[model samples]
Target: MDEDTTLLALSAIAHRSRLAIFRLLVAVGPRGLPAKEISAQLGIVPSSLSFHLKDMSRANLVSRSREGTFIYYSAALDAIHGAIDFLTENCLAGAAGNPSSR
Candidate 1:
């Protein structure tokens, strides 16, 4: 991912609620979970969860789909991996046997 995208994803996950939400979605797998279920599981209010989901979706860190009356949300694997790579990109920058620097 590019710098801007990485920054957006990081900012989106910087909050405790959002982090928990992301982890919850990841644990749920690609099948995803309905918005109501997510809010209930995370102890978040529906309105707050809606705000969080919107921010995450804007960052491309999460995706949403509608199934009949349910709005399902899923963690975007590529975005998660991109954030991880962004954090570890410079790992062991000056250390030996760091394979990462290679």
Candidate 2:
């Protein structure tokens, strides 16, 4: 992803509620969780969950699909992986061959 997209994603996750929701979705895997189930699991109110999910969706961190009557939210794996890559791209820069730090 581009820098702007990465920043947006990072900004979206900087909030406590959003971070928690993202982490929960990550733990749950691609099958995802319904909004109510997510709220129950995270001890969050439905309205609050809706707010956080909206932010996450804007950042492309989470996606929702209508499965009958329930809207299930899943982490966008590509966005998550891109964020991780952006953060770690320069890890231990200039020390790739250094063994002592290992």
Candidate 3:
């Protein structure tokens, strides 16, 4: 992932509610959860959850699909993984004397 994408994903989950939502979705895996289920599980009101979901979707951190009348939201695993890899690329490479060796 590029810097912009990484920043976007990071910013999206920076809020407490958004972070919680993302974690919940990630825990549920690709099967996802319907909006009502997510709100109930997180104790978030429908309007608040809707707002957060919109921000997450805009950041490409989450995606949604319609199943009948329900909208299921899932974490964008690939985007999340890409951001993590980008942020940690070559992590600890320049550490003094290699902590692992100690």
User: Against the true structure, what is each candidate's TM-score?
Assistant: 0.86, 0.84, 0.87
Estimate the TM-score for candidate 1: 0.86
Could you give candidate 2's per-residue lDDT for residues 1-102 as a string of tens digits?
777888989899999989889889999999899999999999999998999999999999999989999999999979978977876674555456788756
- The order by descending lDDT is 3, 1, 2
Task: List where candidate 3 sits over 4 angstroms from the true fold.
Answer: 90-102
Better candidate by TM-score, 2 or 3 = 3
Models ranked on TM-score: 3, 1, 2
TM-score of 2: 0.84
Residues 47-77, candidate 3, lDDT per residue (tens digit)? Answer: 9999999999999999999999999999998
Per-candidate count of clashing residue pairs (backbone under 3 Å)? 0, 0, 0
lDDT of 1 by residue, 1-102 (tens): 777888899999999999999999999999899999998898999999999999999998899888999989999989989877876674434657656656
Scanning candidate 2 in windows of ten residues, the lowest lDDT window is 87-96
Q: Would you list the clashing residue pairs of candidate 1?
A: none
Residue 73 accuracy (lDDT) in model 1: 97
Runs off by more than 4 Å, candidate 1: 90-102
